[model samples]
Target: MNGRISLRGLRAKGHHGVYDFERADGQDFVVDVVLELDLSRAAVSDDVADTVHYGELATALVGVLTGEPVNLIETLADRLLTVCLADERVETAEVTVHKPQAPIPHDFADVAVTLRRSRL
Candidate 1:
């Protein structure tokens, strides 16, 4: 359960925000995901089937990132976590959604939401 797999700086376009312009034109959303799971089986067998595949995981996460438009990054992060935890092998999932081009007028390096969930 302590073993971790992470994907960082995943960029996708999504129409997600409270602003009408945001939903109309869309903006870039960046995501980072960390999945916790047991890797012993894969280590012992050297078989991919025993572990989570990074390529497939990326595609799935991207699907969630671009699939629907939500009003909040919190909602997007929650959905992204769901995608990460869909694999039974994952015991815990941590997701961060970055909205770099957020509607704020002030100068900011980044705006993000981080959420973590553990399997029941």
Candidate 2:
């Protein structure tokens, strides 16, 4: 009955960096989320109510991503994790925030922060 829902490459524009220009010219942040929960109820009842509404989840995440300006991606990741674990049905959640346009001197493909949390 255990199940997993994964959402990847959720892109949103936000001003979340240390530099002033970064705040002025917002950049896109990509988030990937994985949620673990019991699917038995949803599977048997065929009700969206029994399972996490991923579409609504995406909207909530984007709201956080674009909501406030933070100095670190770590803070952003933590905020996203809070949103991920909001539902009681979600036993565990993992979030990865990717900053592809990070201001790095050397050439880099990406910079990301990944955090995982579970209910106590």
Candidate 3:
């Protein structure tokens, strides 16, 4: 009865860091979201209405990512989790925000933040 909807590696350019250069020039961010919900109706009816619309979710995420300036990926992830959990059908959500080109001087692959939330 449980189903998951996932959107991965969504690319966006936004200002999300501490440094002036980071905030001014902006950078590319990757976002991934997973939503858990009941899928029995969708399974039985074979209709899109019974399931979460991932395209709409993605569009909403893009709006959040580009709409405001955040200082941390953790904040971005929290925002995404909030957006996902706003859906009535969703019981739980997991959001990950990735910063590939971090401004760190040391060699590193990437930095990311992940957060989980459930309907109360």
Candidate 4:
């Protein structure tokens, strides 16, 4: 009964960077999460209570993105991972934070940090 839930492209404006201007100006952060858990109860009961409510999880994650100031996308990714693991049902979680507006001299498509955690 193991199941996986994926959430992608959760965006929010965040003041997070090593540079003062970058923090002050803020930038959009995109998050993608994969949650692993048992889905047997939810599958049989047909109730959201039996599984992680992704909509609610998204709101909480956005709050984290917009609420705090961090110096690295790695930290942001860790914070997002923490949120994903808040649900006891989640046995493992993977979070990826994309910083599309990263301050780089050369042309780059994106900069991102991906973190994975498990409760064992």
Best by lDDT: 2
TM-score of 4: 0.98
Alpha-carbon TM-score of each model against the true structure: 0.96, 0.97, 0.94, 0.98
Q: Write the per-residue lDDT of candidate 1 for residues 68-101, one digit (tens) a residue.
A: 8999999999999988988998999999999999
Better of 2 and 4 by TM-score: 4
Error of 3 at 7 (Å): 0.9
Better of 1 and 2 by TM-score: 2
Candidate 4 has its poorest 10 consecutive residues by lDDT at 67-76
Residue runs of model 3 more than 4 Å from their true location after superposition: none
What number of clashing residue pairs does each candidate have, in the order they appear?
Answer: 0, 0, 0, 0
In order, the Cα lDDT scores of the candidates are 0.92, 0.96, 0.89, 0.95
Model 2 — which ten-residue stretch has the worst lDDT?
A: 101-110
Q: List the candidate 4 regions with Cα displacement exceeding 4 Å.
A: none
Cα-based lDDT at residue 5, candidate 1: 90
CA lDDT of 55 in candidate 2? 100
Pairs with backbone N, CA or C atoms under 3 Å apart (clashes), candidate 3: none
Clashing pairs in 2: none
lDDT for position 46 in model 2? 99
* Strongest candidate by TM-score: 4
